[model samples]
Structure formats: structure tokens, C-alpha cells
Target: MEKTTRAAFAFLLAACAPGVFAASSADLSVTGSITPSSCIPTLSNDGVIDHGKLTAKDLGRVTPTLLDLAEIQLEVICEGATVFTLTTFDNRAGTSAINPAHHGLGMINDDQKLGSVAFTLFEPVADAVPVKTIVSRSGGARWAENAYLGHEALTSFAAADGPNTPIAIEVLNARLRAFTIIVPARDLTVLDEVPIDGQATLQLKYW
Candidate 1:
């Protein structure tokens, strides 16, 4: 009887050992290609839009004040012909007095919202050929002309013949226009000198 009991215990241990020690495995794949061509993007004036200064008298009391339009030159040069897109990120996010699609101008006293700015691309020239500005909200799947440049949209230049398709180019030049609007004076505290702190990043991506 002792031998039989010992044999039964050994069988139980053997059956449970496989279940406890068994390992499950999965495979992971890391794959991507490095392109030989690269592109460099630069903006005129070091990408700075100085609004100088603003006083309470310059701002509106009940309506939003519209500042003068600002224009900046954008250039993208590539080692070789390459397809790319341009996007923007609002550094002062969540501080825009207008809609979220617009870039923020920062806040006052860490509570009161300041203003907003909207960017538009115009007169794009790629490889010395005139091209139109095309934008895609669906991650390059589809593109259209005359779309607003926002954080969620991708901006690219299309050849004149191909109105909605992006083309590879060695160089691109475009005008970036910014329209700014300040919040109403009634919604802000103008007791002190408040700086119009607005910053944004224009990013380039390979397609």
C-alpha cells in the first residue's frame, strides 16, 4: 500500500508540473525602411511672428479684435526628389479664445484665455513649377484643395496637372499666412502688461 500511494503522488506531481511550467510564446516583428533622400524645412524670420505690443485700448470690449495679417515664407529643400507633408502643433494648446482648431495665444493669470491664430498656405511652388496646396485629414488617403491648416490635417503641395495628388519635389516654396484675433476686453484683465505669447511648430514628414 505504501508503494501504491507513492506512485499515485508521483503521477499527480508529473501531471501538474507540465501545466505549471508550460510557456506560451509569441513573435514580434520590427520592420521599416530608411529612405536615402531627406528634406529640410526652413521658415523666414526664424519662424517668428512678432505682434509688438498691445494695450487695453487696442482690444475690443464686446467683440473680438482682429490683428493685422502676418505672412511668413516657407521653404523646403530636399537632397533628392521626395514626397512629404507639413503639419503644425500649437504649443499653447487649450488656451485659444476661439475654437480648438485654431492655434492658441496662451492665457492670462493662468485662467483667462487670450486669443487664437489661424494659418493658411498659399502660392505653393514646387521644383519651380506652380502647385496648389492640398490637404488631407485622412492620413494621406485622400486630398483636397483649399483646406484649413490645423493640427489634425496634413498639408502638401500638388502639381498643377494633378490637383489632388502629392508629387515628389526637390524644392518647395510657399507663403504661410497667419490671422490673429484677440479676445474681448470684457473677458480679460488688462490691469497689467500682458504679453501675447503665441507659439507653434511646423513639422515636416516623409510620405
Candidate 2:
């Protein structure tokens, strides 16, 4: 499988200050790194991963116990006003063309759902736009996890069966720019490394 590249960059924006420094705009910005590749490292379905019990031998396999895995961590900052829609795809299903809640629109896990893969957006500040939609593979409302207006510095959700999952994020306002990290593996316990080709699109809606 082909390896994905991980990278990071810092962006700065100038904005007017509201206080004593009103004469000039302040340099507003967010700093972070894009670790595209890291071990997703999954634990046993019923046990903790840290114990290191999930291995080929445990599953009656004769191969070595070392599992190949990796993960992608993307850090982004919205300097000012903006909105975004983030979605993912499980290769077992279709492409990003399908909505996030197609299979279900509630919690991450649902029996009707076929393959599993989920995406969560994290915002440090309370002013971030709530997740408007979490489309699924079946093209219907499957889950409806409520929004945490406050008291949550960051929000996140996990996905199972993500080997061929497609991750995507779309911003409502052109003011926001996005970054990505793509890992070469999923579910560390399985030890199966899959290759993924990442793509993006900025669709403008006019009505």
C-alpha cells in the first residue's frame, strides 16, 4: 500500500481590537500541527488495548504478533466567523456523495448500520457551529447525538470498521481553511494495513 504524507502549518489573521488597542487590528491566529500518520492501534473488542492481548496468536493464527497500524490527527483553528460540515465514508458503503446520517442519525453504533466509521469535530471555544448533520450509508436519519453547547472544550466520536472510511470537511464561509492527516491503518488489533486515497472539494451553493 502507498504511504500518506503528514504535514503542519501555522496561519495568522489580522483583526481589529475592541479595547485600548483599537487603533490597530490584532494578529488573530491559530497554531497547530497535522500529524497525518500514526498508529490507530485498536484494542480487543472486549478487552483493553494497553494490555497487548489482542494478537494473531490469540486468534489462532501462526504469524508474528506485531500489528501494522497508524492514525491521523488534524488540528485546526477558526480565527473568526465560519461554519463547517464534516463527514466520513466507510468503503463498505458509498462515497462522500452520500449523507452522514444515511444509516442512522443518532449515536455512533446502530444495528441497522452495515460497516462502521464516524467523524467528530472539536472546537476549543464555545462559539463553534454545532454539528448540523452526521450522514450515514443508508440515506436516512439514523442518529441524533445532541450538541454540548458549553462545558466541553472539545467534541469527538469514534468509528469501528474504518479501513476504507472517507473523511471530509466543508466550510460554510470561505474564511476558513482546512488541513488533513491520513493514516495507513485502522483497528490496531486486526493488523491489516489498508491504503487510502484522500480527496477534497469546495462546492458553492447559490440560491
Candidate 3:
């Protein structure tokens, strides 16, 4: 009887090993785009305007003016990995990304609130100094407008919690590469003359 029981147990173990001890596989590929869907206009402090809206024409020969990139960003956070990229009005660039900062490490920013991840430059561009730019809506009141620099004090945005909400990635480096701006709403007209509130979008995708 003992020999019979032993043989039965051995047979069961051999049968289970192949199915239970099999190697697993995973496809660790995440994909998305940095689509900033909001924008508004504000006056540059040094400019002649003190308490009025900034116009597109007011922005001199600088191809990319202040009112131009009010909604641009440099870093965007998503599941599995993070991304950062530059934005320009002349070209409609989409989803063209660079290598992951921390790939395969499963680095995910659980923090819902997002801070400025791009660094700022101090070079003078066509007479424009490397000062701070304030972000605000013109219609009602600025929801939250602060300078966007890694080291500077800036307002943070809330996370989406779900898959739909916009998720922004944390900036490992404190450097602003190129310029970014956003109009948070649909109406570009309001962003035209007065400091009225409007909505557009901006995001700094990883390139």
C-alpha cells in the first residue's frame, strides 16, 4: 500500500510541475501623446502693458511670442514610464518620443500633484531677457498663474487618478530646453484683445 501511494504522489507532482512552474512573459510597451488642451493670454511684466492683455502682434519679431506658447510644457507622465519633449507652432508634431529616462525600472509617479519639470535659460533672445512668465486665464480670473521653472516656485496640477485625466511626469532635471505655452479653452478670440479667461491646451512631450 505504501509503495502504491508513493508512486501516485510522484505522478501528480510531475504532472503539476510543467503547468505550474512555467516561465511567464510580458510586453512592457506603453504609448501615448502629450496633448495640452488649454491656453490663455497674459502681459509680460517688462512690456509696456501694466494691467491689460498681451496681443499676438504685441509680441515682436520673435517667431514664437509670449502669447504664442502660453500652454506649452516639457514633461508628461503616463503609466509604466515617463516622457518629455519640445513644442512649436510652426510644426504639428505628435508622439515622436525619446528613450525613457528610467526604463524598465517601473518608475511611476504616484503623486497626483505635478510641478514644473523644465529648466529655464538665461540667454537673451532678440532683446527678451530670461525672466519668469506668469500663467493665467483672462476672462474671470487666473485659475493659477505662476512662473514655470524647475527651481522657481510654481503651482502644481492635480493628477487624473483614472486613465482619462491628464497625467504629467516629474522632471528629473531642472532645465527648460525650449519655450512652451497653452490655451486651455476652445476660443482663441478671447485670448486676442482683453485679459478675458479662455481655455486651450499645452504639454511638453518627451522627444
Candidate 4:
């Protein structure tokens, strides 16, 4: 298995004011882990969802269009049990929104925003036991009862089969839904053939 490595950047921001020139600051912390445990990740349909060909007439001018919902089976199996969460690194940065719900589709000519894509996680099975997507705002103290596919924060996670904490189960299989949309015609004028490229990297984070 390959080694997983990561680095974090922290920043302190202070609010500036004239009358009350007091320093009000907050800590920006990034944390991740590289564990000895390793997992094999796989996606359904050989990880390919082809839309075939498209023309300007297929897209909209004022309003963006949505492609049909695509389903993919996501499975991960570790050599041994380990606790981890999947963190997504959007490859097409600067072309999408900062909101965790959206990831940028590749741009046209490296300028115009092409569109966006989002993934939702569901129907999870861990080590033959049913699993739910749960988040802990209090750092693993409590977790959500139900898990919905949405943009989970870096601090959020999917709970274990029967515990508040996420356990490193031997195998995890889940259904994933991906949403793809096209940018408004006003922004993206596909004068020529352009590739609908959207990429993201998902790394397992050890808690």
C-alpha cells in the first residue's frame, strides 16, 4: 500500500475597528492523519459516466441544465480495521463555489466557468452491518441519527455501524449519487468541442 501524507495550515484573523481596536481572533486549524492501515477504493461502472456528445442546442442560454442523476457504487476495503473519513480535494479549483455542496467542472479556455458537480453518499454497509452517515459537532461526542448525502465538512464524518465513533471496518460499500450541470450559456459559449471534465481526489482521513 502507498503511504498517505498530509500537511495543515493555520491562520489567525483579527477584526479591526477604530473605536474598539481590540484584537478579536479565531483559530483556523487543518488536521489530518496518515495511518498504517490501507484501503482499496473502487467506483461503479469502471468509474465512467459518459454523456456521449453535446451541442450548443442541448444547453440552455439563460438557465443552466441538469443531467440525469447518475448512480455509482463506492466500495473501500482496508487491509485491517481502521477509522477514517473521505476528504475530497477538488482538482478544478477557482472555477467553482467554496460551498462544500459544489465542485467545479473544468472551465472553457481556462477562463469561463463550465459548470458544477456534487456527490451524495447513501446506503452504506460496513462489515456486513448497515451504516449511517452521522456528523459530530462536538468532536465524536454525539452523532446525527440519519445520514444524508450532502456536502460534509472536513470535521464531519460517517458514524460506525453501532457506535458514535467510526470504526475501521474491514469493508464498506455505499451508493453514491452524482449531479452534473452546465453553466448558463451566457457564461460558457462552447464555440468548439470542449471536454466535460470534472475531477476530485478523495483521501481517507484517520481520526
Off by over 4 Å in 1: 1-16, 19-26
Best by lDDT: 1
Best by TM-score: 1
Query: RMSD of candidate 1 to the true fold?
Result: 7.4
Q: Taking the tens digit of each residue's C-alpha lDDT, what string does model 1 give over 93-167?
A: 898888788999998888999999999988889999999889998999999996477787998888778769988
Instruction: Tell me the deviation in Å of residue 77 in model 2.
Output: 2.5
Write one digit per residue (lDDT tens) for candidate 2, span 1-207.
Answer: 122222211111223334534364679899876433221211122211122223323332322222223223333333332232233333334322123322111211222221212233232222233223222333222323322111111222212223222223222211121222211222123335222222222121110
The segments of candidate 4 whose C-alpha lies over 4 angstroms from its true place after superposition are 1-36, 97-101, 135-152, 155-164
How much does candidate 3 score in TM-score? 0.17
Ranking by TM-score: 1, 4, 2, 3
Model 4 TM-score on a 0 to 1 scale: 0.69
RMSD of each: 7.4, 21.1, 20.0, 11.8
| TM-score preference between candidates 2 and 4, better one | 4
How well does model 3 score by local distance difference test? 0.29
Local accuracy by lDDT, each model? 0.89, 0.25, 0.29, 0.68
Q: Estimate the lDDT of model 2.
A: 0.25
Residue 66 displacement (Å), model 2 = 17
What number of clashing residue pairs does each candidate have, in the order they appear? 0, 24, 44, 1
Clashing residue pairs in candidate 1, if any? none
- The candidates, ranked best first by lDDT, are 1, 4, 3, 2
